[model samples]
Target: MKAAVKRVPVRNPANALTVLRLVLVPVFAVLTVMSEMTDSSLRIAACVVFGVASLTDFADGWIARTWGLVTAFGKVADPIADKALTGTALVLLSWFAVLPWWVTGLVLARELGVTLIRFWVLRHGVMAASRGGKIKTMLQIAAIAWYLWPFPAGLAGVGPWLMAAAVVVTAVTGLDYVFRALALRRSTRA
Candidate 1:
């Protein structure tokens, strides 16, 4: 007889970090909106809040794997929290004319598409996070942070370059995910 698998508790440090990220999303959005395209205290506060929340994304994943605290809730909520935080940042940056609307739209579309693909292939198998996905996330966070921070005028050019790289990675990884999803579905059928 096969032994039953041990279950990790949903209420753990790792999942707590994920939850914190989700909660911080709205707070970050409010701060960004309050900034109103100025290098005021509100912008700085928004930057700091966004930085903290972004760190939690890394922390929770590390803690989950290191401490074996992986749970179903974490699996579902982690990505949602990540997308929410990034999505809010992107939208706010675009709204304030900090970043272009097309950039925000493209990133949102790719993110949303990937989520849909995951659901499409859910019955066949779970799609693991790829290395490119991690890189895409890092680029997105760095780009968003660059725009959020009230940096000097001279350094203003850096954010767009970072964002451009992020866009490229995002599109590439998204296509890779779709191809992998299709392969998985086909394999399962055969």
Candidate 2:
């Protein structure tokens, strides 16, 4: 007689945090788009929402590591949530005239392109987030936060520069991932 193997369901607090962050994306977008609200109020609200949502990105990883709750779902959900939040913010900001459309488009293109590459690599094996990727994320978050706030009296000229730096880092890290993925494919073929 063959023994039956039990399949364990994947669920974790980390994934829950990721889902929470995903939910916040729309709320942040709505607040950002409503023109009736004062710029100061909108800026404060956007910052609060973005900060809380961004915190989940870190909190989920910490919870996963601390509780031994890492799972494939967490791996997938975390990055998706990150892209949704950041990408949505960038698009909404551009729509509201807080930023130029080209800036947001470049960021989105890098994010989506890298995401596709990640899915392709997943068929082979896990490719964990790199240090460069982490730096890019931090720079992106900082840029978004600065852009959400009112200019001049706040961070002044720092916002646009930070956003441009983030875009550069995003492109560089994305190319690095593409190179790695291609190398993996070549090695596997050989």
* Best candidate (score: TM-score): 1
* CA deviation > 4 Å runs, candidate 1: none
**Most lDDT-accurate candidate:** 1
Give the residue spans of candidate 2 off by over 4 A: 1-11, 35-38
Predicted candidate 1 versus true structure: per-residue lDDT over 75-125, tens digit per residue: 999999999999999988998888999999999999999999999999999
Pairs clashing in candidate 1? none
Compute the lDDT for candidate 1: 0.94
lDDT tens digits, residues 16-49, model 2?
A: 8989999999888887777322477877797789
C-alpha lDDT of all candidate models, in order:
0.94, 0.85
